[model samples]
Each structure stands twice: as structure tokens, then as C-alpha cells.
Target: MNARLRRIVTSAMALSLAVPLAACGEEQTDAGAGEKTIGLLLPENKAARYENFDYRIISRRIATLCLECELDYRNAKSAVDTQKMQFEGLVKKGVKVIILDPVDAQAAKSWVNSAAKKGVKVIAYDRLAEGDVAAYVSYDNESVGRLQGQGIATALGSQASTANVVMMNGSPTDPNAPSFKKGAHGVLDRKVQKIVSENDIPDWSPAEAKKKMTEVINALGPEGFDAVYSANDGMAGGIAEALKSAGIRNVPLGGQDAELPALQRIIRGTQSFTIYKEVRPEAETAAEIAFRLLEGKSIKSLTSTTADSASKSGIPAKLFSAEIVTRKNLKDTVVQDGVVRVDLLCTKDLATACKSLDLN
Candidate 1:
């Protein structure tokens, strides 16, 4: 194996082993009496990770911690009003704690206040919801953006000095988007020749990203931009389709959320890299926090430190580090963790690519 590949594999393995070990070392307790209910509110269904990974892992962890703990699940489906209704319903159900990945971070402030009034404890999950909450759990988001930027810069190498880049960012309403954009700009501003265009994708919608990409393509033409900074894997696919429609190939795109299609693109050399924040550990951490809150156990010892939200500061939080997933670490990271099963990743069309990577 090449030195670069070997180094990546070792790093990935080390990081992979560290996650579960750290989680196992954390304090855990069994659920007791009164059949407490915990509400889980996810932002939207557009991102495959929410349903395929986040929900499953969180549900499994919650179940493991508390067999009889009632889970009230709801998907906002990208509607702020829908999420508001769901939040209200969860509060009405008198859930002990609500784990929310809000549809609109700013708008959700009112909802958080409402929940607080009703004596419901909220754990902001994945996406940090504004206003007072008991805890926050997510990957270090700004670092996610920095990794995306650094990946694009590294892919272009010396060409980065003169490379015109386009940034297709996530939902303006998402609290994380600003952090992602800020982190990316911190790197790209110093490296790139010029940012040809940058857009905030409302709702983090793939269709919106595609539409914005198409607009960018029309303005910049096929060869105008050297790379694209896609905020997440969902938007990365749309950006890829836009580039393909314009007959632009292999433009060194970067994404987060190591979704299957993004990894496939990395293998085929369409996308340069993606950030993999292991959702299992993130979910498990959130579950641990929720259980402790419900059981009236102190969480001061488990969390790294407190986080500052728009409405409030010093909110307790558990933040996980993210790994940049390139072709080099594909086997050692996602594949090794079974985030995406080999059978699923190695589809008929991706079979040859999978074998080339020794993923078969």
C-alpha cells in the first residue's frame, strides 16, 4: 500500500477504536419506574442519514438503556410549522425529555421557551436549536466546514492558489450552517484565487442546491470554477448532478455526512472527500444524556464542556470530532464500522469501483 493510504488506514482505525472505548467508560445506569417518555424530533427526511443512521442508532441506544422508556418520534419533514406542532405535542405528552434536531434553529427558539415553560427538558441533537436547553450533542460543526475547505484545497494542491471555487452551503435557518460557512471561509479565503459564487441552500434541500448549482453553472460556464464546497453529502449529490448536467467532471467537491452515494463518488473520483462524524457514538451520547436527565442523574462528569447558543450560553454539551473520509480511509472508517454495509455500497454499478478499492 502507498504510504498515504497506510497512514490514513492507521489513523482511521485508531479513531474508530477510540469512540466506543470512550463511550463505554462513561457512566451508565438502568431506567427505573414510571415509564417515562422521551421525544425525538428530527429535522427532515431529505438527508438519508436522519432516517437510516440517526434514528436507528438513537432508538437502539435508548432501548438498551431503558427497556420501558417510551419514545415519541416525529419528523418535521422540513416544515417549521410541522416541527412546532410536533414539539407542542411532545410537551403535551409530558415527555421527560425531548431530543430535538430542529427544522429552524432561530424559529425554534419560541418552541424551546414553550417546552421550558411546560417543564420539559430539551437536548439539542445534531443541529443546535437556539434558546435554553439541558444539553447539546453533535459533531464539532465548524471543524466539519474547515475539513471540507481543507479537503478542497488539498485536492487542488498548488492549483488552489488560482482555483475559482463555489460554495454551496446548507440551510440559512440551521444554526450549524453559519459555523460550517465560517469554518470553510477561514481556510478557503486564504487559499483560493476567488470564490466565484456562494449560496445558502434553504432547508438544506438537494433540489434547492441543484437549482442554485445550475444557476452558478450558467453564470460561470463549465470551466469557470475549479472546485465546489458542498456543505453536506445530501447537497454534494445535487452539486454533482449539476456539474454532470453541465458536462463538468471531477471538480474536487467536498461534503460532510459520509452518505453511501458520497463514498461511491469518492471511489469513482468524482468527489474528493467527505467528513464522517460517526452517528452511532453521537446518538449514544445523546441517549446517555437524556437518560441521565430523565433519571435525575448529574451529567456534569460526562460532557466535555458547555456550549453557547443564540438565546443562552453555557448549555451543557457533548461534541464529537469528525474525520475526513477520502478514498484512502474508506475501508478503515465507514466500511470497518459497518456504517454502510458492503453489500449496499457495492451495488452492481459500483461493483468494479468497490473491487478496485478492495471493498469487495
Candidate 2:
């Protein structure tokens, strides 16, 4: 056998001999080649998960399955051009496969096509890039919007009938923003009095969200808003800060991504609800699928459905569910799944609140 083929055989045997790694009731291992390299291109450092969870878990899994397999990692820092350059570099490095969370879906299509031409398989890691891809793994993102809306409406309760809220949306640059807005608006549109004002913030920045919230609060006069649907937790903090400065009390707030302070605010009754996307399963599952394709194995069991992007059709997709955590189900949702480290969320400051949720 050729050296590369022999290496593949040896690595496959070693991986088969090891127990499939498990977290949150699923198993994953490298299936195909023994000692091949994979490239992982993440979008930015602005979102904490890209570095903290995604990088660590994907690297660990590759190490467990094939000790010699290297991960050529890069962070685009939210630059589309930089990502394209990185993707080209990975292709030049002769990586067997690439897993990418794109900086911009539509802008990255050319790179995806170029890599395909060179015979390097591409997996759309978290964000779906616009192209024919090997596979995709993410949560029910639209459903998350619906949940956030419901959470706000529920928190508003009787007030929803007359509630005038503003929306602080994610970056306009992200394709997901429109879908998330669509989902939230679907529920909120029917019940709420009106959207007093709204803007799609650029780059999903907390600073920008805060600035927007302040501007809206001032423009709307001192009567203030009944609630705000800040797309993610970081931006939610921004809205909350604006609200507090204006002395708006007992107002419902909507958020997602379950950043720690947001959940704590839910406990403190400072914020209403946050959506938990639970990245571990999505990250691990994507890594496993990439490994399978490298090993020349089928991934039918992992993917029972599909996703359609503007540039691709019949893409094998794994869509997981999302949960809306009020102060009520914090334990039942994120904590129950072991998605977040309790020690981190349930610190000395939030210790009582964590026990209140029965998380420990």
C-alpha cells in the first residue's frame, strides 16, 4: 500500500479501537483516513464561542480520533476578505477537508467553489456559506426567533396589547439576522401595540446596540418603551443599560445566545428571557461529519434532513432544537444538557440564583 493509504488504514484502526467520545448523549469519532489534516476557519473573535468552545472541542475531537491529524486554524476577525484568503491558504496546504464558519455567506461563495475545483471538501461549520457544501450543522435558528418573541410577549402579558417596543437586531452583515427578525416579528407582530423604532445594528456590537438604544430612548421621549427585543445576550446588556439609565422599570427584554450576564439578569428580573442555542452538539456533530467524509464513510444517520442556501441545493443538514430559558427553566434547559459549565454561570454572585433554578 502507498504511504498515505497505509497511514489512513493505521489511523482508522486506532480510532476504531478507542471509545467514541460522548457529551450530551451523542457519540463522535473520525471514520476515514488515519493521519490526515483538516482546516477549521472560524469567522471572528467578537463572538466568544468561536474561540472558547468551538476551537477547543473541535481540536480535542480531532486529537482523540487521529493523533497525527492537525487542525489548521484561523480566525477571520469578522473580515470576509481575510476569510477568503485563509480558505485559499488551506487549499494550498493540501488539507483533505475544511470546516468553515464564514464571515459573510454570499461573499464566500467564490472561495467555496475554488476549493471544490481543487478537490478539497468543504463543510459549512456554523454559518452557511453560499455554495455547494459537504455538510451543515446548526440549530433551528428561525425557531429561536419565534421563541424570543414568545418570551417577550409572555413577559409583557396583559401589557402586550398596548406595548410599544423597539428592536435591537444583530448585524446587518449576517444573513441570519433577517431570519431571526422574521421569526421574532411573526409572533410579536400579532400581539404588541407596535414597533416604536428599530434598526439592524452593524457587527452585532454591544457598543452600537447601546448607542442605538440610547438614541431611541431619547427620541421616543420619557414615556419610554414597554420592552426591547435585543437579538442576542451581549446586545441585551446594552439595551438593559440604556433602560436603567432612563429609569425604565419592570420592562420585558428579549435576547438570545445566553451570554452569562443575560441569564443572570433573567434571574435578577432585570431581563426577561434568553434563547439557548447550545453550541456543543452543533460543533461536535459538524466535526464528526467532516471526519466521516475524510474517511470515505456515509453520514446518513447523523443527518436526516437538508438545508437550502442561495448557492446550494440538497445540502445534508443537521438542525438541532433551541430552548427559551426564562428564569423558570434555566436548570431544565442549558444546565440540564451540560452545555454550559455550571461553575462559570453559577458563581458566588449567582450561586443563590443557580440553586433557585435547582441547577445544582
Candidate 3:
């Protein structure tokens, strides 16, 4: 393994030991007859990780931490008003600690402030919500964008310095979106020949990304841009379809969130790369932080860093590192870590590719 991959693996192992998901034979905290509750509010269901990994891992960890602590889970479905209602509902239920991934980070300021007034502590999960947040847990998002930019440059090979690129950014509502865009621009601005077209995709919609890509293709023609930088995997799927429709091939395309489809596309030689941020550590850490808050214990050991939101500064935070996943490291990273099962990734049509990669 390379130095970066080794560091990521080592850090993850250390975190897993610090806050184990399964504490076998360990003494558990009991709430007696009255059960305590922890509120979990996720931003959307569009991203596969929120439901499949974040919710499941966090819930399981919370259960292991305190058997009597019940989780009040709610998904906003990408609606700000809906999330506001959910936040209010959780606070009204007397839930003390709430884990929130805001649909609109800026709009969450008022909601979080209100929750604070009600003696409710909110832990900003994944996306940084603005307010008096008790704690924050997520990956180093700007580095994620830097990885994407580097992936595109690597895919472009000798033409990287003189390559024309199109940038497809994430939602305007998400605070992390600007960081990703800024980080990508930091590299692309100095590395690439020029950025021909750029757009901030609303809701990170795949269809809208497809429409934008089609327009860019029509405006600039097939050979105008040498590469495409998609902020996440879902939009990358649409951009890939647009490229296929335009009969344009061999253009380097990059994305984040190592989704199943993006991995398959990488194997099929369509999408070039995807950033894999291990959500297990992120979610489990958040759960541990929540439990600590409930117990009135200090989270100093867990959160070694601080972050700033619009309304709050010096908020305790724990940010994990991410890795760049390509066809080459597919087996070593996601498959080895059990993030994606071989059976789920290797379909009948992809059997040959899977076998070649020794994925099965």
C-alpha cells in the first residue's frame, strides 16, 4: 500500500478501537423503565449511504452504547421545511441529543438556534449546519474535491496541463458544496488550460446535471472540453449518459461518493474515478459523541479539532480522511473494507470484469 492509503487505514483502525461499534461483554448503561432517546435527522435518501450505511451503523452503535437508548430517526427527503418540522418534532419530544444532516445548511441556523433554546444539543452530521452546534462529524470535504481534481488530471495524462475542463458542482444549499467547488477550482485553475463551463447543480440532481452536460456538449461541441469534474457519483452517472449520447468517448470524468453505479462505470471504462469516504467511522463517531453528550461527559478525546459555521465558531469537530478509488484499488479499498460486498458489486454482466479484478 502507498503512504496515503496506509495512513487512512491506520487512522480508521485507531478510530474503530476508540469507539467500538460492538462492545462484547462490556457493561452497558441502563435507563431502567424510562428510555432515553437520541434524534437522528438525515438530509435525504437520494444518496445511498445515508440509509444503507449511516443510519444502520449509527443506530447499531447507539444500541451497543446504551441498550435502553432509543433512536428517533427521520429523513427530510431533500426538503428544508420538512426538516424544520422534523427538528421541531424531535425537540418537542424532549429528545436531548439530535444528529442532524441539514437539507439546507444556511436555513438550519434558525432551527438549531431554536433547538438550543429548548435545551436540545445538536451534533452536525456530514453536512455542517449553521448554529450553536454541540459537535460536528464528517470527512475533510475540501480534500475530497482536491482528490477529484487530481483524479481528472491523472486521467488526462500528458495533456493535463493543457486540458480544457467542465466543472459540475454540488447543491448551492449544501455548505460542503462550496468547499468542494473551491478546492477543485484551487487545483483546476492552476493546472488546467481553462474551465470552459461551470454550474452549481441544484439538489445535486442527476437529471439537471445531464441537462447541463448536454448543453455544454452542444455549446462547446465534442472536442471542446477534455475532461468533466462531477462533484458526486449520482451526477457523474448522468454526465456519463450525456457523453454516451453525444458519442463522445475517452474524456476523463471524475466524481465522489464511490457509489455502486460509479464503481461499475469505472470498471466499464466510462467514469474514471470516485472518492471513497468511509462512512462507518463518521457515523459511529457521531453516535459516540451523542452518547457522551447524553452522559454529560467531555468529548475532548474524540474531537481533537474545531470547526466554524456561520452562526457558531470554534465548534468541536471530528473530521475523517478520504481515499481516491479507481478501478485499480477497487478490491483493496471498498471490497476489503466490506463497504461493498462482492455479490452485490459483481453482477452476471460484470462477472468477467470482477474475475479479472479478482473481486469475487
Candidate 4:
């Protein structure tokens, strides 16, 4: 989520709920008389998903139902202050509903509380927010982490212990990062020896990961490292580049986010696995939730249970499923379904590798 997006979503909720209680009166079906603006707040531009998928999905869904309704979107750029300021701006602009993906869950409490006081409905997106919220939408993050950890084990085969494993973690600022780390460690820390280096990447930046991996390569010498457990594909690509520059081959690495390059790396066997959180399904879920909220309908049918945030309990939540992606499962998971084109995954250098795996 981007910071600007958080404010936009929160503002939409705030502005919509701000409608005079007497006018709304529990449930008013009239679309023209009630809320008008819908805010979509994302945490940062660190991941391509925010710009490439979320904005379009949300805006298109809003347009389908409410032609006159406006969508106010923003990106926080990984700054709590910036996100908070954006929230205030959206509130001032009078957005009716807010779909928030917070940068700092702790720092977002004040905005959530204030929005609630003013009758705004805040729907926590991908990442959960603190305090009162209307609803939440995200994938099973822990499960995704567990899948990544399990994939690492399978990729290592019988020689996993001989391989030195390094961790390139996601941002500490994000709540999901810790969960992912915990889940991964639950698997890797048990059997793996020599935890070479563990780096908590800032803003999930590849450049930062490249710097850290380069340093690790320098410290450990050129070739002894066995694997890099990069939190996402962006950082995994960075780690791969560092390894290539050092001329250290025979490494098995893992990453999440089936980005184009990561998929290519998987095809070439430079990267072992990636967690594919498909964009269309995730976006469609968000779209459905927003429309449901707008119609004053209970989305209870859409959600199964609740996931509590650090400062909030029993927050309504809907979590989608995530799948493990490897070169082996590439055809079934992404390529066959056309989530990622096979031509993109199989480049000239990777052609031999792809064919060996029976990839057409």
C-alpha cells in the first residue's frame, strides 16, 4: 500500500459517513443523495502492484456502480507523516469512503480514531490499520510466508544444510514483514547452519538489497554462500545481480512476488521460488468489498473471520489465498492461466532450461 492511498481511502470513508445521520437513517438506497467520493490509499510505490494493478481495479469498480462518484487516490511513499497529512487532506476534500493500506500501523491509529469520530468508514486494505475500521481485505500473509519457507526446503534437496542461507527481509515498518520473517525463520533456522547475514530491507528496495548482498558477498568471500532468502522478487533480483557480478554460481535462492524478472530468474534456475499473489483476484476482492460497502450491504458473506491489528481487535477481515510459484509449477500457476506469459519467462538464455522442464 502507498501512503497517499491510505489517506485517500480513509478520507473517502470519513467523507461518506459524515453525511448527516438523519439523512442516511440506517439505510438509504438512493445513490445520488448520500456519499459521493471514494478514497483509495496505498502505502508506497516500492512494489509495482500499487501503480500497475490496484489503482485501476478500484477506480474501475467504483465507476461500474457509481458513475458520478469520485475516487481520490494517494501514495504515502513510506512516510507516516506524509500519510497522515494526506489523510487530513482527503478528509477536507470530503471523500465518502476510504480504502487504506497503512505505512505504519501504529502511527495510523490517530487517523483511524478521528475518522471514526467523524462518522467515516475506513476499510483496511492489503495491510491492516489500527483502531476502528469498516472492513479489511488482504491475502493470507502468514500462509504465504510458510509456503516460501517450504519451497526453500524443497529447492535445497538433501544438501540444504551444506548451503549457507542468508535472509533479506522486508521493511520492519510494515506489520506483515515481521510475520513473513517469523514464518520463514520457523523453517530455515531449524536445519540450516551459518545464518551468514540477515538484512531488513527498507521500503523493500532492490538497490538497498543489492548493497547489503554485495557487502555480504565481500565479507563471506566470493563463492561459499548457498542461498539468499529475499523477501520479495524485487530484492531477489538485486541479490541475484550481486551474485552474478561476483561470479558465484550454483546458488539456490527464493523470493516472493512473481514479477517479470523474478519469473525469468525462476526459468533460468537462478532463483528457486517466488510467492505469486495474483493481482486480478486480489483486485477483484477489493472491488467487491468497496461496492458492497457503498451499497450499505453486509459483506459478512464475503468474509470468513477477523484478524486483529496491533491496536485493534475483532476487525472485520477478508483474506484471499496465495500460491507457491516455481519453474516447475509455472505452467499450472501463472503461465497456463496467462497471469504471466511464457514468452516473457523464457528468454533466449533460459530457453534450454525452460525446455528441460517441458515448458513450451
Candidate 5:
């Protein structure tokens, strides 16, 4: 790891030591009379990481940062209306500091403005929700797309210059989607023969991606596209299934989010690569920023840079780096970082593959 990444990992480790093991499951609302509340609103649960990793990590980090602060957590399940209602509810409950991952970035402008009117500080988490955001925490999303593009080019090898690529992008409502698309296009347009087909999926739905891939296959035949670029692992899973159903094999496929199943597919030689953005530091950083904001403390030390949204400029932001995970460095990247355990990743069925990679 580089110096900055090492510093982030070190900070996360130190914060993790603050909360005891026994306090992990304690009710967050069981605070004293004068205790404050921090609201956490996530965009969706369809992607397992939001509920499985992000929520748990942020909640735990908050507990570690402020034992007296209560967390009001809610998931929008990918519904804009639901998220709006949830945001309104949080404001009504007088939550002064809210960490919001909006379902629709554009729609969040009014919500953020409303919050600001009530003297509530809103921290944009993961997705850059437009408005008067106090602080934004996420990976360099355009860099993520560039990494995916580079992975595809590398996987294509000698055929990269002549390869036809199909692109399956994420939800349009997500503010980050356009940047990912732009970054990927920046590389792929110059590297590949041509982009044969492209589609922006709704809700980042895997089923929709599969259906679109199937349509592309029907229109262009098996040899039409040499490789596929998916914006995320969830949709990539759908694309993988679509390829399988069509009996298409050995096509270079790439995705982000380093999801477990995607990593397994990489081991099995189905998927080419995944971009692993360490969620721990991102979540922990958000928690720390939110806590500091709640306490009216300066967060100049926490944020590394500034980010501009559609409705806001020079917003305090901490953007982290990501790594592209391929079969060659599986052990070095995710394994060494303890993102996934060898025992769990190397299942009974994958014993030979595990042995071949010396993952055991």
C-alpha cells in the first residue's frame, strides 16, 4: 500500500480498538437524556454490501467514535419516494447530523436544502447527492471506471486494439454513473475497435443487465463482441449468467465492488477482474466526519480534498483509492487485506483452484 492508504488503514484499525467486542450488538438508541442522534440513510439493499458491509461498519465506527450518540439508520430499498420520506422523517426527528446516500442524486437537492434550512448538516456518503453537502466520502469513482477499462484492455491482450466491446453501465439516477461511463469511454474509445452496444441500466439491476446482454447476443451473434464492461459486480453477475445461457465462454468481462461471488467467478476464470474499493476506511471516515460535525468540531484534518456536485461547489470530500483484482494477485490484494477469508473463499468445490493458486 502507498503512504495515504496505509494511513487510512492505520486510522481504521485504531478506531476499531475503541469499541469492545461485547458492545457490538448494544442498542444504539439506549443513550442518556442529553445524547445526540446521527441519522444514516442508505440508498438500497439490492447490492449486498450496503446492508452487509457499509451499514455494519459505519454503525460500529459511530459507536466507537461517540458512545453517547444514537444512530437512526434506514434503507430506501432503491426507492426515491421512500428515501425522500425517510429524509423528511429524519429531519422531523431533529437529527442534526445526517449521513445520506441518496437514491436519486438530483432529487436530493430539495431535501438537502430543506435540511440546511432547519440547521441540519448533511454528509453525502458513497453517492454524491447534490445540494449543500457538508462533507462527501467515497472512492474516486471515475478512477474506478478507468480501472475497469484498463482491466478489459489488459485481459484482451493482443486483441485489444481490434476488439469489439459491449458496455453495461449503472443506473442513470446515480450521480456517479456518468463519471464511470465517461472514464471507461475515455480509455475504451481509444483502445478498442468500437463500442458495439451500450445501455444504462435502471436501479443497477442485474436482471436488466442480463436481458440487455441477451438482446445484444440475439442481434449480434456470439462472435459480435469480444469483451464486456459492467459498471458494478451485481450487474456483472447477471451478464455472466447471460453469457453462460448463450454458451458463450472466454470473453473478457470486468466489474467493480469486488463482491464475493464476483471474486469466486474470477477464481473460476469466468470474470476477468474486479475493482476493490476498501469499504472499511470509507465508512469509518464518514462516521468520524459525521461525529465531528455533530460535535461542532473542525473536520479539516479528516477531509483530503474538495468535490463539486451539480448544486454545490468546493464541498469538503475524502476520496479514497481502489485496486483492480485479477487472478494473478488474488492472494496479495483481497486475501492480505482480510476482505475475504481463504477458508470461506476456498470452498470444498474450489479446493483444486485454491491449491493451484496456493490460496490455502
Candidate 6:
């Protein structure tokens, strides 16, 4: 069983034994009691998700929830120090609540502590940081990994017994990466024949993933691995390109993030599948939590359950479910949600593929 399932079972058993603990009552400064500034610190801008979806949805929800509220947004560009500096600047500016998607989960602890000292609440977003935080909002990350692994296994089927698999994971700095890796391994290790190459992506950078894939290709040869377990769509793109450059074709590649390009690749049969975690709900939930904190309101009512990070226990969290997007449900999911337009998806080269697959 995955951590989520285990946790759910544990939570059920512990419910009767649960003792009422004092909630972290809002600590609104004099300035914060009125018009509030909420800091939105995102980890990077490279992934289209942050710029295209996360920021827009979260900002819009905050605007809808609180009219007088202002969002001070900053992208860290995948730099831990830069993120720390941006967070400190928000503190100096007296933002009441900060919703942070950390570049480095462990390193963000110091900033979380600093914000606490000033009576400011820090809500960990997307990726859980290692600290005593106000709240955390993200998808069930282990489920994402399981989906990716299952996709690859489904694609390969009986070949899974003989085929070598390459596991391409996300950045080591982000805490969620390990959960994803563990979850993928949970399924892959038992089903797959062998894992020939596995490596951690330095920054979850496509360029880095491409370079690493190229080296892996050279070392393992073109026909060595029959499947790839790409942690997310960005790295999947890199892996796909590397395979194409090496003249490898029809190799099953699994990814998360359900990026447009990866979805396009799935339709064209160049990639196998991608996991889609609807960002709208996650973003809105975090925004709502921040608004509540600023208004001196309790957030315990908003939480669905609790999660643990490396350094904290029983941290209040709201983790959403993830869906696997393949050729089977492309139209039903991302396309229907307007995450990708039909015209954009069926353009030029993909027109025939889209039509043949009844993607319209």
C-alpha cells in the first residue's frame, strides 16, 4: 500500500483516539488586521504550470476571496538563495501570510522559522517544506508516482519482464521528488525486469534531463532500455528528444504534470502517458487558507487531513487526488478543462493524430 492509503487507514483508526489540540489561532499584526498583503512565492518559471496555471489560478482566487487583499508574487527561478531572499523581503514588507512552493524543502525551514518569529504564517504549497508550517496544500504525490509506474507497465505489458527501465526522477532539493521516486519504485521494482539507469534531475530542468538522457543513451546503447519513468512532463520531453535523436522509437515513456507538449506526444504515440493534478483546486485552497489567516480566522475547518514532513508531525494539509492522462482520456480531462485548446492540440502535425484518435 502507498503512504496515502496507509495514512488514511491510520487516520481512521486514530480518529477516536484523537485529542483536541489548540489550533494555531491567527496572529494578525495591527497592519494585518485591515488590508493585507499575501506573499506568493513560487519555485520556478521554467515549467509552464507555474506561469500558465498555478500563479493565475491562485491570484484570481485570492482576488475573488478578498477584495482588499494584495498579492506580492515572486518567482525564485529555481534558486534556493534567491527564494530565501524573496521570502525575507516579503517578511520585511510585513505580509501577513506567505504561500510558498519551495525550491529547496529543507533549506526553506530557516525562512519558515523566521516568518514564525514575526507572527507571520507560512503555508507550504505544491511541495512540502521541512518545517513547522501553518498548512500544506498539494496533490497525493505518491499516487502520482504509482500512476506513472502503472502507465509504463501497462504500455509494456509482458515485455515488462524482460525490458530494462530507466528511471528519471525530479530534483533532489524538492521533498516531493523522493515520494514520487519511492512510489514509482514501489510498482516498478516488482514488475519490471531491471532498472539499468536511474538518476536525480539537478533542478528539474529539461536541458539537464536531456543531457543526462544523452549520456545514459551513450552508456547503455540505443536498444538497452525499453521504457522510461520520467517523473514529470518537462523531463519526459527531454527523454523523448534524447530517444528520438538516438533513433529509438515507440519506447514507452511515463510522465507527470500532464504538460501540453507531453499530452501532444501522447496523442502522437511518441510518449505513453502523463499524470494530471488539477491545479485549480490546490491553488484555490491555498489562497483560501491565506485569506483566512489574514482575517484572524481559524483554518482547521478547511483542512481535510494532516501530513508529515521531514521535520514536523501532524502538519495540517489538504492533498488532492491525481489523474493519469493518456490517449484514452485526453479530451475528457485537460481539453475539457480548457487547460489545452482543441485547435492548439490539433495543429499542423497533430491534426491527423488528433482526428484518428477522436481527440476532437
lDDT (0 to 1) per candidate: 0.83, 0.79, 0.87, 0.76, 0.88, 0.84
The global Cα lDDT (0 to 1) of model 4 is 0.76
Clashes of 6: 0
| lDDT tens per residue, model 2, 1-360 | 344554453344334334333221211234332137788888989767777677767766766666666667788998888888877776766676889898888888888888788777888876788876888888777888889889889999988989998998888767678878999999999989999998998878888898999899889975767889989988889888988898887888888887778877987788999988866668778878878887888988888799889888989999988888888888666555554567877778778877777866
TM-score of 1: 0.89
lDDT of 4 by residue, 1-360 (tens): 344554454344334333321111122334443367666778988777786667766666566566766667778887889889877666666555678899987788899889878777888888878888888888888887787877877788897777678889998777788888888888887757667889999888899999999999989887656778888999998899999998888688899988888888887778898998866556656767777776677888877878888777887788888888887778777665455556766788888988987787
Best of the candidates, TM-score: 5
TM values, all candidates: 0.89, 0.86, 0.91, 0.85, 0.92, 0.90
Model with the higher TM-score, candidate 1 or 6: 6
- As a whole number from 0 to 100, the lDDT of residue 215 in candidate 3 is 99
Off by over 4 Å in 4: 1-34, 348-360
Q: Distance (Å) between predicted and true CA of 312, model 3? A: 1.2
| Model 2 TM-score (2 dp) | 0.86
Q: Write the per-residue lDDT of candidate 3 for residues 1-360, one digit (tens) a residue.
A: 465765665555444444333211222334231127888989999989887778877877787899778777888899999999878776766778999999999999998998898777899999999988899999888888888889988999899899999999999999999989988888888889999999999999999999999999999999899999999999999999999999999899999998999999988889999999988779989999999998889999999899998788999999988999998999888777767778988989989988999988
Q: How far is 76's C-alpha from truth in model 5 (Å)? A: 0.9
Which 10 successive residues of model 2 have the least lDDT summed? 19-28
* lDDT for each residue of candidate 1 in 109-157, tens digit (9 for 90 to 100): 9889887886778999988898778899987888888888899999999
Candidate ordering by lDDT (highest first): 5, 3, 6, 1, 2, 4
Clashing pairs for predicted structure model 1, backbone only: none
- How many Å off is the CA of 242 in candidate 2? 1.4
Candidate 1: lDDT of 306? 82
